[model samples]
Each structure stands twice: as structure tokens, then as C-alpha cells.
Target: MSQNLAEPVAHDGCLLSDLAAALGVASDTADVRVTSVTSATDMAVPGSLFVALPGARTHGAAHAAAAAERGAVAALTDEAGAERTRAAGLPTVVHPAPREVLGRAAAFVYGTEPGDPRLIAVTGTNGKTTTTYLLHALFEALGVRDGLSGTVERRVGEHAVETRLSGRLTTPEADYLHGLVARMREERVEAASLEVSAQAITHHRVDGLLFDVAVFTNLTQDHLDDYGTLDNYFAAKLPLFTPERSRRGVTLIDDEWGRRLAAEAAVPMTTVSTDPGADADWHLATREVGLDRTEFDLTARDGRSLSSAVNQPGWFVALDTALSIVALTEIGYDLDRIDAALAGRGGLEARLPGRLDPVNPGGEGPRIYVDYGHTPASFRTVLTTLRGFTKGRLFMVFGADGDRDATKRPDMARSAALADVVVVTDYNPRFEDPAAIRATLVRTLEDEFPGLEHYEIPDSAEGIDKAVSLAEEGDIIFVGGHGHRQDVEVRGRLIPYSVKDAARAALAKHGWSTR
Candidate 1:
């Protein structure tokens, strides 16, 4: 799939000498013209500056010859990579850490600067995607041309494009991100919202771009495999609030992690809370949570209030909506205008794909929902919320990811205990044995909750079929783990699969109306 949705239109291009000076490195090819920059060799074009970094398995400098053949005029790499890139007959600019400077280099080549589109960045363990989607919707409601970058999809206003990368990522590589920003600029995007991940920060994926408003949603356990500890994971996200990354910040003080961040963040920040007792700059109180929508009241400590609702269930949706409105106001948008705009549109109407997305076949059958809740906390919240709306049996069909934090698998299983029936299935067992993943989950259920009824089905399609077959009218089938994902990974290969499609097919096979 093409990684870039919008290609760079045209620019005067940057001088290789200028890039060398910017990186504090000397380049032999001083006069070489660099029209663009790219990290992948396949994305290299004529007059392109190819950035080569050291990877876990192989060094990207090995691809210099291929990049040169693909019309990359220059190479940016570390001192070690300089030797190989020069050997490949490409002029090289040597930096100590190529990855750290790649974003700056791409921004220079693509002519993107901070605050050009009024950046709003959201970072957290769970609500990053939901909050960023809400911010993008608010931007549109304010009549601002906006761009969105997140886990599910990347959009430039109304056009959502498939990423050029091989797999979907929460954040794009720095080069692609800069290119995306350049594309947004060409389309006159006045503001944009980005879903920033902890990995994006640790890997320098968000380097060079400074956000106007940075938001920190509640953080929880999930990426312990990468960071080794929850404290380390939280620390990885703290840098996004520094002056180097963002101008201002908004911290959700619902949890201890958030409260710590509010006190520790270097940038001037506005604190918000869903908890009424906590003293926050803005307080979001959930008025009601219906099957289709959640109404909430947002009030500032200074007696300013805005009543609004989100077209989604759960109190979390209301919290995310209020956070979006507060972020908009912090970015200088008027509160009255935001209220008028939302009222004009009937409220905050944003569809969060794969985040509790409903898949109904329009029949008197089970209500199946597809959600991207992989973490233990997410599972607890989603299952508890769905249980309220379920009149009949609540079915949870889920699996843990391989090559990830395996420690949380048992807790994930425990969270599913809220459901009436638990169907353990494979979800992106990248290289680990899918059967083993299921065994861990099954053992957790059997040992911890012996009274709970459960089934182990390694095949996701068959698992969905089983869940649908058991469900009666008014029952709810909650398909968790693989939400908005088009493919499943097994043995390092991504097989074409969709949970929603599988659920719909299962419904149709069981005499339910699919239309």
C-alpha cells in the first residue's frame, strides 16, 4: 500500500550545504540540491535526500545504492553509515544520531515549520485516538481546514488515505509525517490534530514539530514490553509536554499518572478532570450515558460552562468531548463560537472507527460491536459500559497480541469476567504460537473464575461464529482486540481479515438479515 496519501506538490528545494549546516555536520556535496527527503529507499525520488539509520536487524545505510538508483541525490546518516553510503557512490552528510535529526531534515526539505497548521497533539495509553478524533471533528466544526493523524487512519480534511507503510502505525515515521504536514499546508489546512504515542516520542518520530496544544489523557499499563516498567512508559510521554515539543499542554487529572504529569510538565498547562472533587481548571460532569450518546456538562473553575453531548456511549466519550472543547479554547478559539458550532451540528458528532464501532446487520439478532481495546483497563471499561446496555447475555470475543506485553494477558482475561460468555481467539499472533496465547488466556479464566463459562477458539472467524451461534435476541457480542484492523498477523505475515466482516458473515449464516 502507498504510504503517502498526498505527494509534495513543488518547492524551490533546499541546498545540501544548508542541511549540513543545520545538522552541524560537514558534507562533501555542498552544492547538491535536495528537493525532498525520505527514510525508505522505495520512497526516494529524484533530488531526494535519503535518511539512513541503524536498525535492529539491518542498517539502512546498506540501501544507499538502491536509493541512489531511485534518484536520491544525497544521503544523511551516522559516521559509520557515511562510509557505506559513500562507497555506494552517494554524497553523504554524517550526523551522530541520524534518527534524532531525520524529522528536522525532512521538515527543512518539505518546508514545514512549527505552528503552520496550529498543531494539537494527544498522548496517552488509551484515549489518544478518541481524543484526537474529537479534536479533528471540533476543528471541522469551527470551519477550520484540518488534518488528522492517528492509529485508524490519516486524513487531510475529508480525504482519508491509506498509509504508504507496510503496516498501520499509531504514528508515521518522521519523514512521512513531515511530508503529511507539507501536504496539509498545500491544501491550506489551518489546524491539525495528531495522536502521539509513547513509541513515537521514544523513537524520535515526532521530532522537529512543535505543537500549539499538547494533551495528556490518562495513562495505564500496556507497553511494558517496550519500556520495561510503567514509570518508564510514563516518562516517555512526559517529553511531549516540554517546551521543545509543544507550546502549551492539557493534562487529564483523573489518575495518579495524570496528576503527577500536571505537576511535572515543564510547559504551562491547563488541568481537567472528570472527577468532581478534584480541583481542576475545567470539570467535565457526565449528565447521562445512553445506548447511542453520552451527554455532559463542561464547566470552568471561573464560572464558564458549556453543555454538550457526544454521539457515543460511555462517560469516557463525554470526557474526551470536554477535553477536546477545552483544547480548542486553549488554542484561542472562542467558547461561544464552539458552542454555537456544536449546537449547529446538534453536538459533537465524530465516528471513532474501531473504537467501539457497531456492526449491526439490521435484524433481531445479537448486537455485535468491534472495538480496539487490547489493554486490561480498556477491556474493563468497555465491558462494564457494554454490560449496562446489554439486556441479554454479554459475549466477549478477544485475544492478546503476540510480541507484546504478555504479562497483561491474564489481567485482560480477568477483565472479560464481566461478560457472561468469554470466547478466547487469536489476535495478531505475530510470531508467537497462537495456541499458546489462547492457552494463557484460557488458563487465566479457568483458574481465576472457575464459574465463568468460556471457550478457546484459535481461529478468529470460527470464534466469532461460535459467539453469534450462542447469542440470542437482545444479546450483545463484543468483539475486542482487533478493531479497525483490516488484517491479522500470524508467523510474521499479515493475513487479510476483518472482525466486522467475520461477525456480519456469521450473522448472515445464522438466518439473520445482513441487509
Candidate 2:
């Protein structure tokens, strides 16, 4: 994938010495000009400042020569990398920790100042991508040009940047993030919504940028492979609500984590919840959950109420909508204008691609949906929502990602048990045994729900075909785990794949017409 979606059209290159001074580092180079900044050596261009940091497998300093060959003018690194970079005939700036300072350096290089494009950040275990999309759509509805950065795609106004490889990270690296903001500024984008992952904060990807408002959705058990515990995962996300990261905060108090975050957050926070009994600034009451839409009412503690609907079916969708609306209000957008925009457009106009995205909307034998849900909580929520919309049998086709949090595999099986039929298939089995991953899921399902109808298919495409063949009219098929992804990883190779296309082909093969 490309390191960044866009860059500023124009930038007066900064002196290398000035960059070092901004990073609070010492540099010997006096007049060297640095135009851009990047951590990846392959992204280096002429007059670029290459940040070389320590890595797990190898040191980035080892690639200083390659970066220099790619037209990099100077290098920023610690004492260990300084010698290697200097030996490669490039002037180097020495820092105690280059990764920690990368965002600041990139911000300085890209000329990104405070409140540039009016940043709004969303972070949590689930709903981050959808909330960001809703925020961006809300911006458009209010007649404001906006930029978006999230898991599915990045957008600058009407221009959408496709994910380069199998998938893009939920959040880009620090340098690329700053460059995206700079590009937004160039395009005169009035605001930008960023989906900040826990890993992004832990890795220092969002260090330099200060958000006008930071939003926290409900958190659940996820990313245990990185954090090792749920508490650690929550801790990783808490920093985004600090004064240095955001000026105001909006959080969902539906879960304990959200309530805790609201209490612990350093910035001024607005609390929101769907529960009527919960103490929050805003309360979201679900008025209706139709097949195509979910109507909700947001009432403030001060007795103000705004009614709206999301063109998606789910109570969770209502929560996400309420969070987005409350976030807008916290950022000083008029509540009446926000309500009018929603009512005028018949609800949120943003199509959350791969997020409960219907594959065969009109012409179809079975209603099929491709979703990006991977966590246990996400699976439970999506499956429960799909159950309400399904008239006939519900077929759940999904698999766990190999080399990820394997502890959640059994829990995932329990969630999928909600479906009438479960088809276990291979997902991205990167560097791990695909068969073993499938076996774990199969064993769990068989042991826990022996009477449940299930099938084990290693190939995801074949699994979809099996599900389609079994599904009758009015039935629903949900393909999960690889939503919006175009490829599957196995043994470190990204094989071309798409669940939506595969499901369509399967439907066609079963003598069903597809659009």
C-alpha cells in the first residue's frame, strides 16, 4: 500500500537544522533542505528527511543507505542509528527516540499547525470506522468540505483513495497522517475525521496532532495479542483523551470502559448513552428499528431533543449516530442544523462500505451481507441485528484471522452460534497454519453446540458457495472477517480475493440473478 493518500501541493522546504531544532535534537547539517518526511525508505523522495527507528526484526537504521539511494537528503535517528546513517554519507539528527518524535517532525515538515482542518478523532474497540464515516457524512450534510481517514478508505472531499493492498491500516503511520492533513488543508477541507486505533496511539501515530474533539465508543476485549490484557488495551486508548491530544471529548457510557473513560478523561467531556437510566449528557432512545432504517431520538440533560434516523438496521447504528451527532454538537455545530440535515437527507447518507454492506440489494435469491466484524462483541451484535431482519434461516460464514488474538476464537464461535447455520472458513492465515485455525473454531462449535448445523470449509469462496446453495429465498447470508478487503493473506502472500464478489458468483451459480 502507498504510505500516504496525499501530500501538500506546495510547501516551502524546511532546513535540516530547523527540523532538528523543532524535534529538540542536535544536528550538524546547517543549510541542507528537507522538503518531506517519511519513515518508510521506499517513500523517500529528493530532499526528504528519513526517520529510521528500531524495529522488532531489524533496525530501520540498516536501511539508511537504501533511503539515501532513494533521494533522501538526511536521516533522523537515535545514537544507534546515527552512525549507520552518517556512514551512508547522509547527515543525521540524533534523538533519544526517533519514533516518539516522528509525528512532530512530520507536522513541522508539512507545516501542519494546531486546528489545521479542524481535526475530530474517534477511538474504541468497535464502531470507530463507522463513526468516522458518519462524522464525515455529517460534515458533507452540513455543506462543509471534509476529509476522512479510516479502515475502509481515505477521502478528500469527493475524491476517495482506494486501499492499496489487501487492506489499509485503521490508522496510517504518523508521517503519512500529517501529510494527509496537509493535503486536506491544500484542498481547503474545512474539517477532517480520523479513526484512531489503540495501536495508533501506542505506536505514536497521532502524537503531534491535537483534535478539536476526541470520541470514545464502547470498548470490549480486542487486540489481546498486543496489549496482553483488556486493561492495557483500554490504557492505550486513554491517552487520546488527554489535554495534549484533544481539547474536548465525547464518549459513550453504555459500557464500563466508556464510563471509566468519561471519568478519567482530562479534557472536557460530553457523555452519551442509549440506556435511559445511564447518567449522561445525551440519552439516545431507539424509536424504531425497521428493516432498512433505525429511528432514534437524542435527548439532552437540559431537556433539548433531536430526532434522527440511520439508514442502517441496528440499535448499535443508533448509538453510533448519536455519538456522531453529540460529537458535532460538542465541536460547536448547531443541533438544529444537524437535525435538519439528517431530516432533509432522509438520514445519514454515508454508505459504510463493508460495514453490514448488502451485497445483492435488489436482485437476489438470498440476502447477503459482507461485514468487517472480527471481534466477538462485533459478531454477536451483527448477528443479532441480522437475525431481526432475516425471515428465513441465517447463515453465518466467517473465520478467525491467524496470528492474531487466538484467545477470542472460541468466543467467536459462541457468537456465531447465534446463527441457525455456521460455515467456518479460512480468513487471513498469515504465517500460521490455516487448518489449525479452522480446527479450533470447529472444535469449539462442536463441543459447545453439538446439535447446531455447521460445515467446515477451508476455502472461503467454496464456503460461500456452500452457504448460498443451502440458503433458500428470504434467507440471509452474512460473510464476515474480510469485509471490504480485496485479498487474503496466507504464508505472507496476499492472494487476490473478495467476499462480496465471491458471494455474488455463488448466488449466480445457484441460478439466482445478481446485480
lDDT for each candidate structure: 0.88, 0.88
lDDT of 2 by residue, 1-515 (tens): 33244232478869888988887778975458888888887777788888999988888999999989989889899998889999887889999989999999998888988776899999988899889888887998999999899887788788875433233578988987887888788878888899999999999999899999998887887899999999999999999999899999998887789888988998899999878998889999999997678898999999888988888888998899889988888878989999898889888877787899888889768999889989999999999988988989999999999889989999999999999999999999999999999999999999999999999999999999999999999999998888889999888888999999998899899999887
The TM-scores, one per candidate, come to: 0.97, 0.96
**lDDT tens digits, residue span 206-245, model 1:** 9989999998888888899999899999999999989999
* Candidate 1 segments whose C-alpha is farther than 4 A from its true place: 1-6
Span of 10 residues, lowest total lDDT, candidate 2: 1-10
Model 2: per-residue Cα lDDT at residue 303: 89
